[model samples]
Target chain A: MENNINDDNAPKTCEYDPNVNQDELIKAQEKQIAEEIKANTAMVGSLDGLSSLEEEYSNDPVYSSKVKTLLPKFSNVRRTRPDGNCFLRGFIFAYLEYCIHHRDELVRFKKYLESSKEELFEIGFPKFTTEDFHDMFMEVVSDLEGSGSIDRVEAVCNDAGTSDYLVVYLRLLISAHLQKNAEFFSFFIEGGRTVEEFCKQEVEPMYRECDHLHIVALTAAVGVGVRVMYLDRGEGDALVSHDFPEDKEPIIHLLYRPGHYDILYKA
Target chain B: MPMFTKLAHKTSTAAKSSGQTAAKTAAAAAAAKGNVTSPAGKHFLDNTRWQKRLQKELMSLLKEPPPGVTVDVDQAHTKLTEWVVHMEGAAGTLYEGEKFQLQFKFSPKYPFDSPEVIFVGENIPIHPHIYSNGHICLSILTEDWSPALSVQAICLSIISMLSSCKEKKRPPDNSYYVKTCSANPKKTKWWYHDDTV
Candidate 1:
């Protein structure tokens, strides 16, 4: 049905202007449509019930088993829009929400973040850029104090500017972590790429997908543990869980599919 | 050089007045007044984060500018969106002793969005990549722009572009493009095919 409409439109364009390069025009139109679709989708969404997951995996036994396991321990999943930056966004929202519950952890995280600013500046990030991101991050975190509500957190996280700024700051922190401890991280980096190179190629860019190396560096940098539960087709009755900052309890839980990550909230 | 310094000094003072504090007060007032819309019906509220970021950038650039770059806001004591950067051609290059001006127009979604940057001045540089009407065909100013790049880095890139030119010449299509191109070069889909200019 869609193909017939496209075919009809194609002949009409040639009729209007025979000189026009129809192929190039069609390609440009497709590109514009793709960009519009990307722009309309949010990077992160509000809290949603886990019924969607059940509906999604109802037919697939492997995924169904994973969902069944998660359903008993988790009540809700705040879905981060799968825009490549999902891991960072998921980590941030989950961590901030955790801070909202644990006051002392929030205080410690604030101090760590304050000191991390100087570390970022020392690593050759211009003071202006670092300060700008740091200030916005601090403002968002501070708002979680006292009467700060989850609704306010969701609003700010959903705001394009604030959310992107926070993501960039986290990327910087991850870069700083890897660079600061290059000797340790260099050992893990594959393909002869140095820690700095990895950060530039993988960590610094806004849309780069997060890898295990990124997860480790970020978890270490922010002084938080994250448990990523993998739900895949691999043979397993239970979901595979990998904890960052090994041997420690994780406060933040993330559900990881093939190429995306979202926050997992325990009941 | 002295004129550049004076201009920088003047702009810094102007920026101080309309910087963070002024933006905060404006935001507070807007909040109190409630739903202030512009003549165009767009919200009249300032993006405080963008204002603060630009203000900090302006302050830092003024305090410790890169070796060959001098920057000043386009308008004095007003919006921080537009900036005029002056670049001195690096010594020992074809453009040594030459000066150029670049106009940078930033959107509220700055850092995330690349600023619309173009060369501007009476005497535009005669370079293969730089058009007669001061449109620069540089990747970093367009597709290659990264949030990690700063105004200083852009100025340095432009200076280096001028410095590397062995012969002074306008782009091959300079005349035709200048006549037909839009006022804002950002709208142009520039095909940067040349490298050794």
Candidate 2:
């Protein structure tokens, strides 16, 4: 067989010399730094005025100007931890905060969530663990049923185990959306990888950061419109905002500053 | 609520355990992992979520194991967190008759964190990716691991790895690696450079 011939000549043997030890040491040190960052930062911070952003960017004229321009449209920001789960964590925090004020939206979202477990199971996720995570998410959503307040939302979002479960479920939703619609998404996936592979490598793993594809999939999957305001050093006097589905009215607003995401409240 | 007594299972991959009879080695490895606390200080055997997940996986493995694989029944009762999975190289392949065993140790963070997996036997297969020290250089065991993968999936992958081998040869640096490598394979920073075994 041609395959056997190819394998005979090209024995892909993995080799690791002494120099490779540096990578392990570096990775361990990075983990140490990440732990320190986690210790110093809250998973989700309390809401604060936009002036904090202004002060953070005061030294850089470009960012300072961008922050000043953002003042009219956004009033405050609630920062999330810089760990890779920030986007997912921040998204749910902001959405639940909005749901607190808008009972109708909360009812609609809960209806969608209640039926998601079966769909995830259908998508071949491990039934037992997936169901466990789904149940945890359901419990959190159910918490907001009666007289839900922002303080209560904040408390639930900051609880370590509960909050992480919600993020994992959200990731599954995105993975499911991508796989279910693989025919269309297959065109967008580069590097010769299939939709299934992309989801396994990028979406299913915990602590893997979200990207534009992730944002697009999550918003489209849940039918929740998100508008992210970019405060990057990219040349701009005003902050640039991109809506998730191009033009759907955004229910939740987020601030994106390079590697991190935080919730934004309208003035 | 099942709290196993604390046991030192740090060197779970030691070849010495397998130098003894297979049945006794199984019990030795099982006894070593009686109780290991997770980073959160919760014992993995404390009927925690990880324990439940492991329990579910073990049940499935026992009920409908993959072909050429079976968990040592004696090890099943000793520890929920550690399992000694006996695997035979797939039939009609380069290693048709050879058998091997892998030790799986699950932390509380699994399936999010990969279970520490390594070959544990006197007859560590002579494969390019498997070192003499019983460390296996496989992507799925390390950086490429996803929570979705299970013990069955891993067994299939390792069997597939052996089944496809064109020749029997140890890794180029097998001796040097065995001398310097850590006991835990997960900590060794494996680079899965070759896929065309």
Candidate 3:
């Protein structure tokens, strides 16, 4: 008896082309779908909170305008690429949050910083030893404490060299200290005045540029900053290699002449 | 199905023409009776040594994870050559609860060649440095990659990178992502620069 092809009990026939590998094709499709789901889920989960913070900041006209202006300038160099450095990105956001919160004080300090830069040039750069870097740190602290922005200065000091949070404050401090100041460069010369001379004449007056409390707070932060050089290098290189730390110390080789300092440790 | 049939016919024809000895023929005949392993089968079998090593390491990690992190490996729908991992970090800001998909494409060279890793996600955050596609711009993944570097090291570096991000800005050309991204994102290579983050 011949089977009826149209009967429901008849064996199923696949209508697909014999040349195609359906199983392989289906697996490929499934893989693609899985990847799509994974990617979308990751992005949505990470960005939701940041978007809200951005929304609030975007609403403030003055703050938004400044951010817009500064962003373009700061980011012009890396236009085509993405920054993979997450810690640095976080530090920058934190600093921006700081500036936005302290806008009025920032305005005042920016003005003082502009004038101080000129003085920095006239007074000259110091060949700061570890002690000089410390002294510089203390001087900034005293000035910050006097300025009544001691709280801001203290917060900065506490977090110093620990994260990139200090970069913003350091940028502000450097701007205030170095503007129009060509003299600070003099001490960096090979045979220039010792760090002692440079500290006495140049860094000592940093206190005058801002309130004494503010100066002291900033000074203490610098003490931490100077040590970042060590942390940046971390526990030295082993032959087999080791995982590098996230919070790298600043590459502070700038203060010491090329061959002068090799003590290596902070002791 | 067609491909398998074609391979089967070809293997049978070759076996008939070769006129192999009975002992060797019996082994192949048995293999064919069960399943016809492809030409790449030998390499795949040998390649599992490294795969096994990686899997064991991953399993050990899952049992006792690092601070602020969790990881999972999925093998359900991949080419045996590909390994996919999912990561989450609880302690880190901006990245907390964020799941990142890392796909690894191992080359035939195995442990010698570092696997290609890409973050696959749409609507990924743009930082001044991060491109629309999740190609990281760090040195370790490229010129600085050493055999000593492991999957955990790379993940940790990524976590650290996210934690340190200060600007919260995306790549400057984020608006162009839709225009420039390829139909198949995995094929595109990313350009990385800037020592200062």
Off by over 4 Å in 1: A1-43, A59-62, A183-194, A235-238, B1-46, B72-79, B121-148, B160-197
TM-score of each: 0.73, 0.81, 0.30
| Candidate 2 per-residue C-alpha lDDT over A1-267 given as tens digits, one digit per residue, 9 for 90 to 100 | 555555567755654345555434544554555555555667789889999998998798888998999899889999987767789989999888888888889889899988888888899887766786787776667777774787777766765545666777898999999999999999988877789878876787666678888999999988899999998888758788899988799988999998789999899
lDDT of 3 by residue, B117-162 (tens): 6666543544454555665445445323332345666667666666
Q: Per-residue lDDT for B1-197 in model 2, tens only?
A: 00011111122222222211222112212223333432212312233656776888888888888888999867866987789999887878888888899999887666666788888878888888787877777767765566667887788778877887888988777776776666777666454453456
After superposing candidate 2 on the true structure, give the runs of residues whose Cα lies further than 4 Å from its correct spot. Answer: A1-24, B1-47
Looking at model 1, the pairs that clash are none
Ranking by TM-score: 2, 1, 3
What TM-score does model 3 score on chain A? 0.21
Winning candidate number (DockQ): 2
**Candidates sorted by DockQ, descending order?**
2, 1, 3
Give the per-residue Cα lDDT of candidate 2 at A45.
92
- The per-model DockQ list reads 0.08, 0.10, 0.01
True contacts kept of 1: 0.03
Whole-model lDDT, candidate 3?
0.35
Chain B TM-score (model 1 vs. true structure): 0.72
Q: What are the fnat scores of the candidates, in the order listed?
A: 0.03, 0.12, 0.00
